[model samples]
Target: MPDSAALVKQLMFTFDDLVELDPMSLGVLIRSCDTDMLVYALKGSKAPIRDMFIGQMSERAGAILRDSIETMGPVLARDVEQAKNNILQKAKNLAEAGAIVIQRGDNANSQVIY
Candidate 1:
Protein backbone atom coordinates (compact mmCIF):
# COMPACT_ATOMS: atom_id res chain seq x y z
CA MET A 1 0.00 0.00 0.00
CA PRO A 2 1.11 3.56 -0.62
CA ASP A 3 1.97 5.99 2.14
CA SER A 4 -0.40 8.85 2.93
CA ALA A 5 1.84 11.36 1.19
CA ALA A 6 2.00 9.16 -1.90
CA LEU A 7 -1.76 8.72 -1.84
CA VAL A 8 -2.30 12.45 -1.63
CA LYS A 9 0.14 13.03 -4.44
CA GLN A 10 -1.68 10.52 -6.60
CA LEU A 11 -5.00 12.28 -5.96
CA MET A 12 -3.66 15.74 -6.67
CA PHE A 13 -4.84 17.58 -9.78
CA THR A 14 -1.87 18.41 -12.03
CA PHE A 15 -1.30 20.82 -14.88
CA ASP A 16 -1.17 17.94 -17.36
CA ASP A 17 -4.64 16.91 -16.28
CA LEU A 18 -5.96 19.96 -18.09
CA VAL A 19 -5.95 17.77 -21.16
CA GLU A 20 -8.84 15.81 -19.72
CA LEU A 21 -11.04 18.87 -19.42
CA ASP A 22 -13.70 19.58 -22.05
CA PRO A 23 -13.20 22.49 -24.40
CA MET A 24 -15.56 24.80 -22.53
CA SER A 25 -13.99 24.02 -19.20
CA LEU A 26 -10.55 24.54 -20.69
CA GLY A 27 -11.62 27.88 -22.13
CA VAL A 28 -12.87 29.00 -18.76
CA LEU A 29 -9.62 27.95 -17.17
CA ILE A 30 -7.51 29.65 -19.82
CA ARG A 31 -9.45 32.87 -19.46
CA SER A 32 -8.97 32.80 -15.71
CA CYS A 33 -5.20 32.36 -15.97
CA ASP A 34 -2.81 35.29 -16.36
CA THR A 35 -1.13 35.42 -19.73
CA ASP A 36 2.34 36.10 -18.31
CA MET A 37 1.97 33.28 -15.84
CA LEU A 38 0.83 31.03 -18.66
CA VAL A 39 3.89 31.90 -20.68
CA TYR A 40 6.11 31.01 -17.76
CA ALA A 41 4.26 27.80 -16.98
CA LEU A 42 4.41 26.71 -20.59
CA LYS A 43 8.11 27.40 -20.93
CA GLY A 44 9.14 23.75 -20.90
CA SER A 45 5.78 22.08 -21.42
CA LYS A 46 5.01 19.39 -23.95
CA ALA A 47 3.76 20.28 -27.41
CA PRO A 48 0.28 18.90 -26.83
CA ILE A 49 -0.15 20.96 -23.67
CA ARG A 50 0.95 24.13 -25.46
CA ASP A 51 -1.16 23.33 -28.51
CA MET A 52 -4.31 22.67 -26.51
CA PHE A 53 -4.14 26.10 -24.90
CA ILE A 54 -3.14 27.98 -28.03
CA GLY A 55 -5.81 26.21 -30.08
CA GLN A 56 -8.57 27.50 -27.81
CA MET A 57 -7.85 31.17 -28.41
CA SER A 58 -8.50 33.42 -31.43
CA GLU A 59 -5.84 33.27 -34.15
CA ARG A 60 -4.26 36.60 -33.23
CA ALA A 61 -4.32 35.86 -29.49
CA GLY A 62 -2.92 32.41 -30.04
CA ALA A 63 -0.18 33.78 -32.25
CA ILE A 64 0.76 36.35 -29.66
CA LEU A 65 0.86 33.74 -26.90
CA ARG A 66 2.80 31.38 -29.09
CA ASP A 67 5.27 34.07 -29.88
CA SER A 68 5.64 34.94 -26.25
CA ILE A 69 6.39 31.35 -25.43
CA GLU A 70 8.88 31.13 -28.24
CA THR A 71 10.69 34.31 -27.26
CA MET A 72 10.72 33.78 -23.50
CA GLY A 73 14.18 33.31 -21.96
CA PRO A 74 15.02 30.66 -19.38
CA VAL A 75 12.60 30.52 -16.48
CA LEU A 76 13.32 29.35 -12.96
CA ALA A 77 11.91 25.94 -12.11
CA ARG A 78 10.32 27.31 -8.98
CA ASP A 79 8.54 30.06 -10.93
CA VAL A 80 7.14 27.53 -13.35
CA GLU A 81 5.97 25.38 -10.49
CA GLN A 82 4.37 28.38 -8.79
CA ALA A 83 2.49 29.40 -11.92
CA LYS A 84 1.19 25.87 -12.47
CA ASN A 85 0.09 25.70 -8.84
CA ASN A 86 -1.74 28.99 -9.15
CA ILE A 87 -3.56 27.71 -12.20
CA LEU A 88 -4.42 24.47 -10.43
CA GLN A 89 -5.80 26.43 -7.48
CA LYS A 90 -7.99 28.40 -9.87
CA ALA A 91 -9.22 25.16 -11.40
CA LYS A 92 -10.05 23.75 -7.98
CA ASN A 93 -11.93 26.90 -7.07
CA LEU A 94 -13.85 26.75 -10.32
CA ALA A 95 -14.72 23.13 -9.70
CA GLU A 96 -15.93 23.94 -6.19
CA ALA A 97 -18.10 26.71 -7.58
CA GLY A 98 -19.78 24.26 -9.98
CA ALA A 99 -18.40 26.16 -12.94
CA ILE A 100 -16.39 23.14 -14.12
CA VAL A 101 -15.99 19.46 -13.48
CA ILE A 102 -12.60 17.87 -12.96
CA GLN A 103 -12.93 14.21 -13.78
CA ARG A 104 -10.28 11.81 -12.58
CA GLY A 105 -9.50 8.11 -12.28
CA ASP A 106 -12.46 6.08 -13.50
CA ASN A 107 -14.50 9.16 -14.38
CA ALA A 108 -11.80 10.75 -16.48
CA ASN A 109 -13.59 10.06 -19.73
CA SER A 110 -17.15 10.24 -18.44
CA GLN A 111 -19.66 12.44 -20.25
CA VAL A 112 -21.14 15.45 -18.52
CA ILE A 113 -24.94 15.81 -18.51
CA TYR A 114 -26.60 19.19 -18.64
Candidate 2:
Protein backbone atom coordinates (compact mmCIF):
# COMPACT_ATOMS: atom_id res chain seq x y z
CA MET A 1 0.00 0.00 0.00
CA PRO A 2 1.05 3.61 -0.48
CA ASP A 3 1.64 6.18 2.22
CA SER A 4 -1.88 7.51 2.38
CA ALA A 5 -1.09 10.02 5.12
CA ALA A 6 1.32 11.98 2.94
CA LEU A 7 -0.91 11.77 -0.08
CA VAL A 8 -3.75 13.49 1.73
CA LYS A 9 -1.61 16.47 2.72
CA GLN A 10 -0.47 17.16 -0.84
CA LEU A 11 -4.00 17.07 -2.17
CA MET A 12 -5.15 19.45 0.54
CA PHE A 13 -2.64 22.04 -0.56
CA THR A 14 -3.45 21.42 -4.20
CA PHE A 15 -7.15 21.81 -3.53
CA ASP A 16 -6.50 24.87 -1.41
CA ASP A 17 -4.52 26.51 -4.19
CA LEU A 18 -7.14 25.63 -6.76
CA VAL A 19 -9.95 26.95 -4.60
CA GLU A 20 -7.91 30.08 -4.10
CA LEU A 21 -7.21 30.83 -7.76
CA ASP A 22 -10.27 29.72 -9.66
CA PRO A 23 -12.73 28.79 -6.96
CA MET A 24 -13.66 25.25 -5.96
CA SER A 25 -16.43 25.04 -8.50
CA LEU A 26 -14.12 26.18 -11.26
CA GLY A 27 -11.45 23.67 -10.28
CA VAL A 28 -13.92 20.82 -10.32
CA LEU A 29 -15.23 21.94 -13.67
CA ILE A 30 -11.79 21.79 -15.27
CA ARG A 31 -11.24 18.26 -14.07
CA SER A 32 -14.49 16.83 -15.37
CA CYS A 33 -12.65 15.56 -18.51
CA ASP A 34 -15.78 15.42 -20.62
CA THR A 35 -18.83 14.36 -18.67
CA ASP A 36 -20.20 12.56 -21.66
CA MET A 37 -17.03 10.54 -21.98
CA LEU A 38 -17.12 9.72 -18.28
CA VAL A 39 -20.72 8.61 -18.63
CA TYR A 40 -19.76 6.45 -21.53
CA ALA A 41 -16.93 4.90 -19.54
CA LEU A 42 -19.43 3.79 -16.91
CA LYS A 43 -21.41 1.82 -19.55
CA GLY A 44 -24.17 1.43 -17.02
CA SER A 45 -22.05 -1.01 -15.06
CA LYS A 46 -21.53 1.17 -12.03
CA ALA A 47 -22.06 4.70 -10.80
CA PRO A 48 -19.45 6.99 -12.32
CA ILE A 49 -17.06 8.79 -9.99
CA ARG A 50 -16.89 11.66 -12.46
CA ASP A 51 -20.36 12.59 -11.37
CA MET A 52 -19.09 13.14 -7.86
CA PHE A 53 -16.28 15.39 -9.05
CA ILE A 54 -18.57 17.32 -11.35
CA GLY A 55 -21.28 17.82 -8.79
CA GLN A 56 -19.61 20.69 -6.94
CA MET A 57 -17.50 22.06 -9.75
CA SER A 58 -17.74 22.32 -13.50
CA GLU A 59 -15.29 20.83 -16.01
CA ARG A 60 -13.23 24.00 -15.77
CA ALA A 61 -13.02 23.60 -12.06
CA GLY A 62 -11.67 20.15 -12.63
CA ALA A 63 -8.87 21.67 -14.69
CA ILE A 64 -7.81 23.73 -11.74
CA LEU A 65 -7.84 20.70 -9.47
CA ARG A 66 -5.69 18.80 -11.91
CA ASP A 67 -3.26 21.64 -12.33
CA SER A 68 -2.93 22.11 -8.62
CA ILE A 69 -2.32 18.45 -8.02
CA GLU A 70 0.14 18.17 -10.84
CA THR A 71 2.02 21.25 -9.82
CA MET A 72 2.20 20.17 -6.22
CA GLY A 73 2.75 16.41 -6.29
CA PRO A 74 0.88 13.24 -5.54
CA VAL A 75 -1.97 13.47 -3.06
CA LEU A 76 -0.91 13.12 0.57
CA ALA A 77 -2.89 11.57 3.40
CA ARG A 78 -2.47 14.62 5.61
CA ASP A 79 -3.72 16.84 2.82
CA VAL A 80 -6.63 14.54 2.23
CA GLU A 81 -7.25 14.37 5.96
CA GLN A 82 -7.36 18.13 6.13
CA ALA A 83 -9.79 18.28 3.28
CA LYS A 84 -11.83 15.60 4.99
CA ASN A 85 -11.84 17.68 8.12
CA ASN A 86 -13.02 20.65 6.12
CA ILE A 87 -16.02 18.69 4.99
CA LEU A 88 -16.52 16.92 8.29
CA GLN A 89 -16.30 20.25 10.02
CA LYS A 90 -19.30 21.32 8.03
CA ALA A 91 -21.13 18.01 7.58
CA LYS A 92 -21.82 15.22 10.02
CA ASN A 93 -19.81 12.02 9.67
CA LEU A 94 -17.49 9.93 11.74
CA ALA A 95 -13.83 9.44 10.85
CA GLU A 96 -13.72 5.67 11.07
CA ALA A 97 -15.31 5.22 7.63
CA GLY A 98 -13.04 7.66 5.90
CA ALA A 99 -10.91 4.89 4.44
CA ILE A 100 -13.95 3.24 2.91
CA VAL A 101 -14.77 6.43 1.10
CA ILE A 102 -11.47 6.30 -0.79
CA GLN A 103 -12.50 3.12 -2.52
CA ARG A 104 -15.85 4.70 -3.35
CA GLY A 105 -14.27 7.32 -5.63
CA ASP A 106 -13.92 10.00 -3.01
CA ASN A 107 -10.25 10.59 -3.91
CA ALA A 108 -6.83 9.04 -3.53
CA ASN A 109 -6.88 10.45 0.02
CA SER A 110 -10.40 9.34 0.86
CA GLN A 111 -11.71 12.86 0.81
CA VAL A 112 -15.26 12.79 -0.45
CA ILE A 113 -15.49 14.81 -3.63
CA TYR A 114 -19.23 15.05 -3.49
lDDT of 1 by residue, 1-114 (tens): 569875575357678988888889989989999999889878768999989989999899899999999988888999988888788778878977889887765665664321
TM-score of each: 0.83, 0.31
Best by TM-score: 1
Off by over 4 Å in 2: 1-51, 74-76, 93-114
RMSD (CA, Å), each prediction:
4.2, 14.0
lDDT of 2 by residue, 55-104 (tens): 45646755654444435544545555454344432222221334212122
Candidate 2 TM-score over all chains jointly: 0.31
